[model samples]
Every structure is written in C-alpha cells, then in structure tokens.
Target: MTQFIVSLAVFLALHSIPAIPAIRQRFIRVLGRRPYLVLYSLASLAALAWVFHAAFQLDYVELWPPSAWQAWFPLTLSPVAFFLLISGLFSANPVSVTFRRGDMKPGAVVSITRHPVLWGFLLWAAGHIVANGDLRSLMLFGCFALFALFGMVMAERRNWSNPLNASTSIIPFAAIAQGRARFGIDPAMILALALTVALSAWLLLGGHAALFGTDPLAMTST
Candidate 1:
C-alpha cells in the first residue's frame, strides 16, 4: 500500500508539472520544446508503469461488493468511452493534430466537447469505479476521473486567451448549441469510429482480463 500510494503520488506529480505554466515553460526553454516533450513522455510512461506494477501487486481489498447489475455498468459504457477516445484522436483540438495545424477547424468531436480525450478518460474511470467497488480499484480509477475532470478545466483556462476557443466548452454539445463549434463527420472519422467499437468489444470480451488479470464478464456470470 505504501508503494502503491507513493507510485500514485509520483504519477500525479509528473502530470501536475504541465499544469504549472512557469515550470513547464522553464523546462521547455531549458530543454527545447521537442526534447522536453520527449523526456516528459518518457518520464510519464515510467511513472505510469510504476503505478500499474504497484496496483496489480496489491491484493483485492473490497470496499463494497458491487451489485450484480453494477457489472454491466462499465460494459455498457465502454463503447461510448471508446467512441469519445476515437473521436478525440481525430478531433482538431489543442492537444492533438491541431497543435501543429493551427488553422484547422474544430470537427464533430470538438463540437461536442473541446476535451474529448479527457471526457473519454473520465467516462472510462467513472464506469470502472461503478463496476469494481473495491478500494484499490476506486483509488486507481478515481485518480484518473479527477485528473480528467481537472485536466479539462486546466485546458480550458490555458486556451482562454484565444477568442475563437473562448466560447468552446467542456460540456457535450454545449459549444454546438452556443454556435461556437460545428459538427462535421467525414468517412475517415466514421471508419475510425467503427474500428474503435470493434476494439472496445475485443477488450470487454477478453483483452481486459489478459492485460489486467480481471475478467469483467466473469463478474457478470457470478
């Protein structure tokens, strides 16, 4: 538990560095933008690996056994979560391709939420917390949920100075209703969405157990 907590702290701390503009900028300046990004990515992966190692080593300490129906929660939500993730991958937002292509217009995904990836992570984490009902799972998933929620807030604040992004929102379809963003889906995005659904199905069926040592489907059977 001590190692788990420490690993979690290290992961969160590494993530928090980007939220601090001065420190992030200083690192960028000192290391150069590309090198800084590379190093940060490597460090983040290391911290994430430590977190997973610690988490998987801990025995299941149940907080409350999930109700039978709770087993379906994550299963049902996984497709939607994957959709958001896939859409976010293709969305023209500050984080992905738009970072390089400054002139790119917001797409269907961004029309729903400026932070689609974060929303995806939020849903994935929240759904797991609802389904697992274990102390270790709660702590692991809850951290991700909070990180996604707070990261969205931070992202919005970071882009606040841009007039075009000013009216964009974190809430789904809010920006579209406000006339700040529009939805346009191309064939490529549609294909990506289909692939994401297939991947989600694969994960829910057996990939999750193979990777995490827990079968969500077995929970339903019991």
Candidate 2:
C-alpha cells in the first residue's frame, strides 16, 4: 500500500506540471514538438509501469466482493471501448481526424468536449474499479482514472490557444450541409472497424490468458 501510494503520488506530480502556455511554448521551441511528444509518452509509460509494479507488490486487499450488479461492467464498457478503440483505429470521424490532421477544427466531437481519449480512459477506469472492489485494484485503476481526468484538463488548457471561431469556421460548414456535420465514413475507418472486430475475437479466443495472464470473461462478478 505504501509503495502503491508513493508511486501514484509521483505519477500525479509528473503529470500535474503546470499548463502555462509560455512554459509549454518554450519547451516546444527547445525540445521540438516530436521530441517533446516522445519524451512525454516515455515519461507516462514509465510512470504507469512503476504504478503497476508497486500495486502488484502490495497484497490484494479486497474491499468487498463484487456484487451481482457488477455484471454491468462489461455491458457499460463495451460501447465506450468500442467507440474509443475504433475511433483510434479508424479515421472516419472528423473528431478522430482532427488530431491526425493538425487542424483542431473542434467539430461535432470537440464542440461538445475536447478530450475524447481521456473520456474513454475515464470510462474504462471506472468500469474496472466498479467491477473489482479491491484495494490494489482500486489504487491501480483509480489512479489512472484520476490521471486521465486531470491530464485532459491540463492538456486542453494548453491547446485552448487559437481556437477557430464558430461563425467563420464551424457554423458555415454545418449550415451548408447536414452531412458535413455528421461523423463521416472513410475507408480507413472501415478498415479500423474490421480490424477491431477481428482483434476482439482473437483476444477472446486464444490471446487473453497469453497477454494478461487471465481470461477476462472468466473473472465474472459474484
């Protein structure tokens, strides 16, 4: 528990670095965007690894056995995961593409919210924590949920610079064509969906235990 708490605190500290535009801009200028992104990714992965290591080192402290109601976990998570994993895999929705395109249009998806990935991560984290009411499990997954939520806020604060005006950029296109506002379809998106389906099937079959050391479906709630 001590190790888990310490690692979690460190992870949050690393991620909670202030979101000042000037400081971030300076870092971008000094490190270059690609290098900075890579550095951030590496740092995040390291922190996550440390958290996982510390968590497993602690005894699996059961808070309470999952209730029968906990069966709702997969039902709730499936859709959220499907959208997030599929959106990430495919490139159909303008929301998904905006990140790839460097456009940052703040279209239908971004108009409502800025951080889809973080949102998805939040759902995933919540689902896991709810289904597994154990101290180790909660610490491990809850920390991630909190991190994702905070990361989204900090990240959006930094990216809030130079947002496109609705009148000139978004509204005109939305007013001109109903289809334009729609989350469009594309071949990449189709490919991503197809691949996700296949990967999901494979994971359920022979891949679950090999990868995670346990079968997901086997770990049913009481």
Give the number of the best model, judged by lDDT.
1
State in Å the error of residue 164, model 2.
6.7
For model 2, the local distance difference test gives 0.57
The TM-score values for the models, in the order shown, are 0.76, 0.63
RMSD of each candidate relative to the true structure? 3.8, 6.0
The 10-residue segment with the lowest total lDDT in model 2:
90-99
lDDT of 2 by residue, 1-222 (tens): 787888889887755532234454476679986786578668867997888778778887789876667746854675555555445422212222122333323333333233444555677788878877898788788877887767656664544553332221222234334432344445544554566577667766767567546555666633
With candidate 2 superimposed using the best TM-score fit, by how many Å does residue 154's alpha carbon deviate from the native? Answer: 6.1
Q: How accurate locally, in lDDT, is each candidate?
A: 0.75, 0.57
lDDT of 1 by residue, 120-140 (tens): 778888989989888888989
TM-score, predicted candidate 2 vs. hidden true structure: 0.63
Error of 2 at 51 (Å): 0.9
